[model samples]
Target: MNLETIQANARSSLGDALKSISVQGVAEHSGKAYGIVALMYHRLALCEMLADVRVDRFQVLLCKSALVRIHLMRLAASGKAAHPLTTCASQNFSFVDAITAGQLDLAVELARLTSDRHEPRSEYEDDFLLHRFMQKRLLHLHAGEDHDFQSLMDRWERIVEGEHAPYFDVCRALLQRDGEGFHDALLAVIEERGRLFRQKDVYPEDARRTDGALFMNGLALLRLAELNGMPTQREYPNIPHFARLPVSKLPLPLDSWMRPEEGLPV
Candidate 1:
């Protein structure tokens, strides 16, 4: 709960994670690294909030974002698809992590890089479609044309229902150019995520450890809105002011994020 405790745990977690990557090797253990790196970011992110009431290592988060991309690409290679477009769900925050932390240019590239590694399929699994839509809508706002975004949303509107529908609504509201609707839908998904976190239903248990107070998902979407010139609330309930603001410029000589090929140093 305390920042001090979270910081200590983060150190322990990072140390343990490095050993795991060193022993298991990055090629075989990327999924594990992805999960662990996610935890590290949350812990560090939480420490920033709890310690100084602001985030400090968001650049590190940007770095972790790249690592997550690498991990997911590797994970996809092992899946049934010929490419790495695996099923993404409420639990999948790597895209959110990437989108929120990096600038639009950098963040969009993360999605592009992941998708490029995979060949196109005649039909994407429903779950794959859902996850891709989540990333695509944001990409559409900045990079794609309005017509393309609408077509994409129309495709998702049919299949997405039940518990996951609200997530789509968040994007839907944005597409409709409804700011209040966007805020309302965004809060809904953020609250739902909080509930899931409280129930310990989140994967990798550590994902929830620090984020119990800070909701990065909400911030990511808000940042997406900001990037697209959409009006955003100055503040949301669970999402703090600092976490929502821009982090820092991408660290150049981008090797800082472990670069996947280089392997984790012990």
Candidate 2:
């Protein structure tokens, strides 16, 4: 099958998984319900990531459903006293309805969780850092002045310390002005990213892990660099292992499921 078919199958599998999760007989604000919601959030976020790469709309809906469920979980966990499962009709779960009726803040947080798992936390991290670093592009394209990246960028700079320091530096420089050193800096970070990818031992093993996205992550970075005028012919060494892997086998990063944090949608 082609990329599209593989993606469809993956999305279907995810939908089936979501359907199989029984929220019945579980108490609100209990650890059991929280665990199930967290699992749903984790898998939904993963599907959202996949949808992003393939530009799939149905997968985006799946993500919205996951986000909505997360909002319901949050409400229940906070002692708001609402039936989580009954929030949506049993026969049909409308993702758009959920987003419209749910919390936007929660959706953003979910986006970040999936994004954070893209690669080594230090090197390729961002608030909504996955999918070729599309959050920045999205912010530039769609977000208003109310949306600021300063804090997220600061967090990223803090996390990615040392030899990989140039990662965000290049990002900032490119953000400021594409100067003579822009291409060099971009290539430098990409090279460092490639080096990190070579070290498979650096990744964590978890059910919701996204370590497998390194190949996609690298390709996204390379495309971004080239889009901004980085050299096209430059040798990208030893990274095809990621490209070679089947799209279905990639993993989502995690274990921080229930831990409260931030995110955004693709």
Candidate 3:
């Protein structure tokens, strides 16, 4: 599909999502915490697409992150178990857009709240660690704070040491914007996840699996940014319109991809 069609679909999806989750305007509903974060992640992916299509739509995409937190807040109000994003106050704290918008101090405080004084036994420790890394990187870039990136890695090491080793590598590469490493790690992840949807698969029963299309789309955009000399720094990242399509059928060896704007050779 063309970029305009894809963006229109994204807009409709976001609207339906907001209406479904925000029942009675409380944003209370039954869904996994992982699912919520995944939704926010997908919105960020769409934001990347929007950036490619029109830089002006960036403000809209940035606002979606706050909506994710608001949804989490309503979930907390319903006594949903606390994950990193679902924490009582952290849910209300500033996120990526806030930092980009020059709200550095609030962003730093929020990162502190996410990272400090966590019990080892918390089921969501790794989740919190990931957010800590994201926030710390934002702070380091925007505020020039001296937050130790290694400390964050150490925390992940404690949790993701063996068996979870792949995740450890993937998350590290992703946060560090190691495009080639991330491309490899993400392929491994998708391979292990396998096909969530088969031909003629139906809804609800078939919808429980993660949306690999969206995830791959995000990765494709990231790779494009890296190739175009934009390695996801403090500034917003973008790609050409042709590169923003869902990559469900995109070939592998993404690091060596030919220019999408020039049309890949058949």
Ranking by lDDT: 1, 3, 2
Candidate 2 lDDT, tens digit per residue, 50-103? 435422322333334444455554454456555423232220122221222222
10 residues in a row with least lDDT, candidate 2? 244-253
Return the TM-score for each candidate structure. 0.71, 0.38, 0.45
lDDT of each: 0.59, 0.39, 0.44
Per-residue CA lDDT of model 1 for 34-137, tens digit only, reads: 55655565466556565566444554554465455545555564572322223233334566766666555655655554442112352344445545655666
Instruction: Put the candidates in TM-score order, highest first.
Output: 1, 3, 2
Name the candidate that leads on lDDT.
Answer: 1
Better of 1 and 2 by TM-score: 1
Indicate the TM-score of model 3.
0.45
Each candidate's number of clashing pairs is 0, 12, 0
Q: Compose the digit string of candidate 3's lDDT tens values, residues 137-198.
A: 65665457787778779877988766545445666785566767765665565554444344
